[model samples]
Target: SPHIVLSTLTSYCPRSPHIMSAISKAKKSADDARDAAAQVREVLDKIRSALSHHAHDTSLLVRLEGELVAPANDVIRMKTYTETAAKFAGHLKELSEKVGERIQLHEDTPASQRTLNVAFVARTKRNASQIKAVLCQAEDTLDYLHQQALSSYAEVVLEKGARVIEERKEERKEEQNRQGKNQS
Candidate 1:
């Protein structure tokens, strides 16, 4: 965003509006990206809250073939996805902060001290676009993880219910055999 401000002070091509237009478009993209990152943060916070509660309760869920058949495992998987999302958001946040520093550096230097270059401006725009792409990927990953978690929870619930029914059936059969022997 600072680049947007700085460019207004020094337009390399005085009559060319193309650079200004590109900067405007890139600024809008960065703003959208920042909003997307905020949404991701909200999701991660919820996941962290749920994960903390269920992580300790993993022992309560069913186990099959020595594997954890539990929603906690699903939440754990979701956490990994959230972590990747957080990483991209953090990078974007850091890059934006750099703009402030760059602005300060530009201000401290006299106009005659340095020439205005468009390459840095172009690089900043590219970084914003790249960060936006990363945020999009993060959103997609979160959605996929959410779907997997719902399916996994249902599967674990079914397995637990089935195991309970099977155990009861065995117990009842044993009782009936003992009763028959007693009656005989």
Candidate 2:
């Protein structure tokens, strides 16, 4: 009886492309997000170092602004990946829930029938557990990406604000120099 149940479960457990595809896509997205985050970090570091040494250099600020564009684009890409991952996680959660319901139904059957379905229910439970694990991983990845994007955006805004203030100060200094010359 056990052998028959094992054979039946094995035969029915054909690998589902949907699960594999979701996993592959999630992995790729996560890799991309990591790369993007790294890029953002690198750019921010460079900006920080340059600012420390050349805070009054307008040309350096311009160059840093140009450098920031790539990281900003990376952040946008990360945001997109995060959204896609969220959708994928939602779908996986639904599938997991359905599997759980199926397991419960099998368990609720009459004792004689439940005995026969024991292996099947066990396999379903295992699958459901795996789905939950993947779902949790997806959520974690989404949160990470979201935080990176927000952080990058904030840094960029602050850098731009600093640049604007520096430019204004330079303009004011020039205006004062011109006034002194005229008065002389």
Give per-model TM-scores.
0.34, 0.39
* Candidate of highest lDDT: 2
* Residue ranges of candidate 1 with Cα displaced over 4 Å: 1-131
Residue 17's lDDT within candidate 2 is 41
In candidate 1 the C-alpha lDDT for residue 146 amounts to 48
RMSD of each: 27.8, 28.7
For residues 1-184, could you state the per-residue lDDT of candidate 2 as single tens digits? 2224323333433343443333344445555666665665565456445444643233453465457557546555454555644554454445346445544655556556544676755754554455445434544554577555444444433444455456567878999999999999
Tens digit of per-residue lDDT, candidate 1, span 102-159: 4444455554543454554454345344434544554555455444444443443344
Candidate 1: pairs in clash: none
